[model samples]
Structure formats: C-alpha cells, structure tokens
Target chain A: MADFATIGQQFVQFYYNTFDVDRKNLAGLYRDNSMLTFESAAVAGTAGIIEKLVSLPFQKVEHRVDTLDAQPSSEAGGILVLVTGALKVDEEQKPMSYTQVFQLNPDGAGSYYIFNDIFKIIYSAA
Target chain B: MADFATIGQQFVQFYYNTFDVDRKNLAGLYRDNSMLTFESAAVAGTAGIIEKLVSLPFQKVEHRVDTLDAQPSSEAGGILVLVTGALKVDEEQKPMSYTQVFQLNPDGAGSYYIFNDIFKIIYSAA
Candidate 1:
C-alpha cells in the first residue's frame, strides 16, 4: 500500500514549483492518454495540454494552495486528488480563487502519471 | 459504451435538483466507500457526507452551473466530472463562486454511484 497522503503532498509541491518556475517541464508528468480541461476548453494528450498551458495570458504566476484532499480511486493504485487555491498573476493585487482535480494512474514502473486534470479559475480580481 | 457526456449532464441536473429540493435523498447516490471533501474538511461514507451537507449554514439555496466537463476515467466505466458554478444561498444578493468534482463509478447494476466528491466555495459574497 502506498502512503497516498505523502504522495499527494509531494505531487502538489512538485507540480506548483514546476508550474511557477519552468512550466514546460511539467509536460513530462502527463501521458498520451492524459486529458486537461482548462475552464471550458478540453485538451487531450500531453502536447496539447502543454501547449495550452504555456500559452496562458500571464507570464508570471504564483499558486498558494489552501487545501488538498486525496482518495484511492482504483484497485490498480490510481489516486484522485482535489485542490483549492489562490492564484496571483501578473502583478495583480488580489489573488484569484481556483480549484483543480487530478487523476493519477500507476504507470507500472512504481510511478504515476496524470490521467485527467481539470482546472477552473472560480473568482477573478475586480 | 455509456454516453459519458449525457450521463454527466444528467447527473449534474439530478444532483443539484436533489441537493436543492431534498438534500437527504442525495445519500442514496453514495456508497460506503464514497468520500467527500467539502472545503477543508474531509468526510467519508454516506452518513458523514449527508450530515455535513444537511447541516450547512443556509437552508434555501440554488446552483447556477456555468461549465461542466466530463472525461472517461477507468476501464470499468468510471466518469470524472468537473463543474464550475455560482451558488446563491439564502437571500444574499451576490452569488458565491463554487467548484465541484464528482467521480462516478459503475455500480455493476447498470447505474453509477459517486465514489469521490469534492466541493469548495471559492468565493464568498462580500
């Protein structure tokens, strides 16, 4: 059995660090079958997801995670993680609220890859 | 193969309707293994989830969904649904922004049950 809490925490830290510093490197965390639903748009595959992420309007952003919850999703070592956070972008005075969910599937190499990702910016700064 | 898009839409409608009209009935949609993360608190199983939901601060509430996205999650016919919407509670003039994710797993009876549910109120009325 895997310590899902630790894994979830580690993944969250790694993901936000990579996203804020070097977003392109985050592509390696996904697989060909991975899907990302960004707001209203759905992008499939790692290439498309990465492209969509790298093309976001802001050049500088920071994520402050407020809560993280994880659960076992499958008998095959899959994990489901849900996160709520605030995002500060482009020298904005007020941080926007956001929610993200991730489904991680075991890759048979004692590792996991992002199988499904959903992200939404719930509240925008006035 | 199940029509995931239609299933997702129907589930969203049924869920909100039941939540608004008769929240206690929502317990039937979850199983013993089901888990719900509401904001920073995590509740497991049907009893805990229902208790938490029914004890919420407000009595009269309505949900206005802005976007709903669904994707296939498992080889056994699980669906991952992400929803972003505004919630109006009580008589507040301003609606609060919210995000919810539901992982519906096949119940082996030609139906699906919520295996994982995460809900967060991203923005509160000012």
Candidate 2:
C-alpha cells in the first residue's frame, strides 16, 4: 500500500515550488493523456497544459496551501488530491483564494504522473 | 465510451438538488469505500458523510454552479468532475464561493457512485 498522506504532502510542495520557480519543468509530471482545467477553459495534453500554465497573465505567483486531502481513487493505484490554498500573483496586496484537484496515476514504476488537474480562483461572494 | 460531460452535468444537478432538498437521500450515491473531505475535516463511509453533512451549521443552503469541468480519469472509466460555484446558507445576503471535486467510479451496472469528494468554502482574501 502507498502512503498517500506523505505522497500528497510531497507532491503539493513540489508542485507549488516548481510552479512558482520554473513552471516549464512541471511538464515532466504530466503525460500525453493528461488534461488541465484552468478556470472555465479546459486544456488537454502535456504541451497544452504547460502552455496554459506558462501563459498565465501574472509574471510571478506563489501558492500557500491551507489544506491537503488525498484518497486512493482507483484499483490501479490512482490518487486523488485536493488542495485549498491562497495564491499571491504579481504585486497583489492580498492573496486570492483558490482550490485545485489533481488526479495522479501510477506510471507502473515508482513514480506517478498527473492524469487530470483542475484549478479555480474563488471570487469574493460579497 | 462514456460521455463524461453529460454525466458530470447530470451528476452535479442531481447532487445539489438532493443536497438542498433532502441530504439524507444523497446517501444512495455513495458506498462503503467512499470518502469526503469537507474543508479541513475528512469523513469516510456513507454514514459518516451523511452525518457530517446533515450536522452542518446551516439550516438551508442553495448552490449555484458557475463552472463545471470533467475529465476521464482512469482506464476503469472513472470520471473526475470539478465544480466552482456559490453557496447561500440560510438567510445570508451574500453567497460564499465554493469549489468541489467529485470522483465517480462506474459500477458494473452502467451506473456510477462517488468514490471521493472534497468541498471547500472560499473566504475573501481581502
């Protein structure tokens, strides 16, 4: 059995680190079949996902994760991770609330690749 | 092949409708192996999930979905559905933003059940 808690923690750390520093390097974490839903747009495949991430409006961004939850999703050892966090973009004074989910599939080896990712920025209800 | 978009739309509609009207009836959509992460708390199994949900602070709530995204997650025909919406609890004047992810596993009988669910309420960053 896999230690999903540790895996989820490590993945969250690595993902935010890479996303904040070098987003292009995050491509290796995805495969050709991967899909990313950013806000209302859905992008498919590694190239598209990376392109979308790299093309975000902000030049600099940081993610501060508040909660992380993981669950074994499939009989094939897929992991579902949910994260609620705050994101600071550019020179923004206050961080924006965001929620993201990642579906990770074991690559038959000791590693895993992202199968699906969805991210959304939560606007204030007021 | 499963029509993930249609399935996601129908599932979201049914889920929120059941949740707003009679949350106890939503138990049929989950199984023993199901897990739900509400905010920072993790609840497992149908009974626990229902208890946690029914015990929420609000007397009445309504969800208005803003975006819905779905991706085929596994070879086993699981679907990953992500929803960004707003929730009005009781007599609150402003609806709070919320994001929820649901992993639906296809049962052998042409139906699907919730394998994992995570919900979060987004607070104002300002």
- What lDDT does each candidate get? 0.87, 0.89
Q: Residue B31 in model 2: shift from native, Å?
A: 1.2
RMSD of 1: 2.5
- List candidate 2 segments past 4 Å from native: none
DockQ scores of all models, one per candidate: 0.50, 0.73
Model 1, first chain, TM-score of: 0.95
lDDT of 2 by residue, B51-70 (tens): 99999998899999988889
User: What TM-score quantifies how close candidate 1 is to the native fold?
Assistant: 0.90
Write down the TM-score of model 2's second chain: 0.96
Off by over 4 Å in 1: A124-126, B124-126
Candidate 1 chain B, which ten residues in sequence have the lowest lDDT sum?
B117-126
Could you give me the TM-score of model 2 versus the true structure?
0.93
Model 1 agreement with the true structure over B8-36: per-residue lDDT tens digits? 99999999999999799999899989989
Q: Looking at candidate 2, what is the lDDT of residue B50?
A: 96
